[model samples]
Target: MNDIWLTTGETATLLGVSRQHVVDLCDRGELVCTKAGTHRRIRRSEVQRLFNPQLTREQEKSLWLHRALMGHLMLDPQKVLQMATENITRWKPKHRADGIAMRSLEQWEQVLSGGVDVVVDVLTGLDEVSSDLRQNSPFAGVLSDVERRQALRSFREHWDHEHTAA
Candidate 1:
């Protein structure tokens, strides 16, 4: 199962590019592949590595946490809310600033318990909060953006690998 191999066409389709593009990538040594008689055969892992590269241990853990949180949000909102509240409480003290009140946990619980619409509102409100904080906390903003991108990239890689393997 882990030894899945894809032809150039299949690789191109998975990568959302042209077959010639995949060929070019292989030729340029950007994508690893082996020749199967006349055609090129690329290992699924190689293709995935080309798209996702590698992440540090902390980045990997953060991606796993993000995926688990998203799964919980979809399957068990109550559990997600509970976990989020606990996490907020644990991290609030570390992030406490002069004007920042530790009131978000209460508000988060309220919105999470309200319904889907309220959850959406909470997400929107969090975006605004992040923006406001970003202005004063440039390091936090950079770290957050990097974490978010890594989480999303890892999630997409897992999703694509799962479906493609299936």
Candidate 2:
């Protein structure tokens, strides 16, 4: 029986992962998927397919691209584009320099609602964070805790390279 698949966002939410994680898993042959307008659709049957664990051409490409991007970021820190994801400001403000200024949408409702260029820190629950702001933010998106942990390592690698090179 052919079962209808769920959307990437839905699967990502249900799986407690980022949309990018969902995409990556699908690309890596861990999850069989179909793409529709930048989103992915995962079938229930495909979940079982993941148990087989065989690499496909698509998976190879995905893996290669992943390695290439990581290598590029490591080798060429000068070309990397950085963006701010979250900003938390305490009651006492500190000297700021580089990027966007962010504060709680709760305490700093004015700053958040001012339509500034940076992401606003709105008071939100974890579930709300997965649903609402994740969809809207161009600069940030939700990732599975595992993915976040890995991404953090990847980021650290890049940052460390930049520091050493400088």
Candidate 3:
């Protein structure tokens, strides 16, 4: 239990997938693994990487912006949600012919309609769906210009510190 390696079933539990799926991922070269005698062993880090794949600099920055919005959302859920609704209403017409953007916008509408818990989940999600939704985020203008600048500055400073420390 104190070992750094995990069994396939353990990895599956962490990834919210079946053990066979973890095996398939290892076989497909999606997740790295090694054999311990006849059993497969994966590093804890490998499982973490699969569950939370790394983000690009731009994606990290976007996450920071949303985090700023999330702060406001917590303080005033109705007002934050209203701004998102308005943004969706405005962007929907312009993106009517754009399949990807339209899908993201539609998903945003559902998330917003589902209320604050749903919104918070999607806002901080690091999954592919959340990443795609963020590409066409409807939370624009939820934060003031000064807030946006502050969030971005904070992100940059943190990013710099992390990289330098590493």
Tens digits of lDDT, candidate 1, 1-166: 2359999999999999999999998998878899979899999998887566554443444435344345446676666566655665666677655435445544554555587555534332223442232222211222246666776777668656754544
Q: Residues 50-163, candidate 2, lDDT per residue (tens digit)?
A: 444444333433333333344333454333213211332331244243323322223233423443322222212222232233223222223346654675676556556653
In the range 48-166, model 3's lDDT, one tens digit per residue, is 78667788888888877887898789999999899899988888888756588888888899999999999998888897678677878888888889988989899999889875654
Ranked by lDDT, the better of candidates 2 and 3 is 3
Index of the highest-TM-score prediction: 3
Pairs that collide, model 1: none
- State the displacement of the C-alpha of residue 83, model 2, in Å, after optimal TM-score superposition: 47
Cα RMSD to the true fold for all candidates: 14.5, 16.4, 3.7
C-alpha lDDT score of every prediction, in listed order: 0.59, 0.45, 0.87
What is the TM-score ranking, best to worst?
A: 3, 1, 2
Clashes per model (N, Cα, C within 3 A): 0, 2, 0
Ten contiguous residues minimizing lDDT sum, candidate 3? 157-166
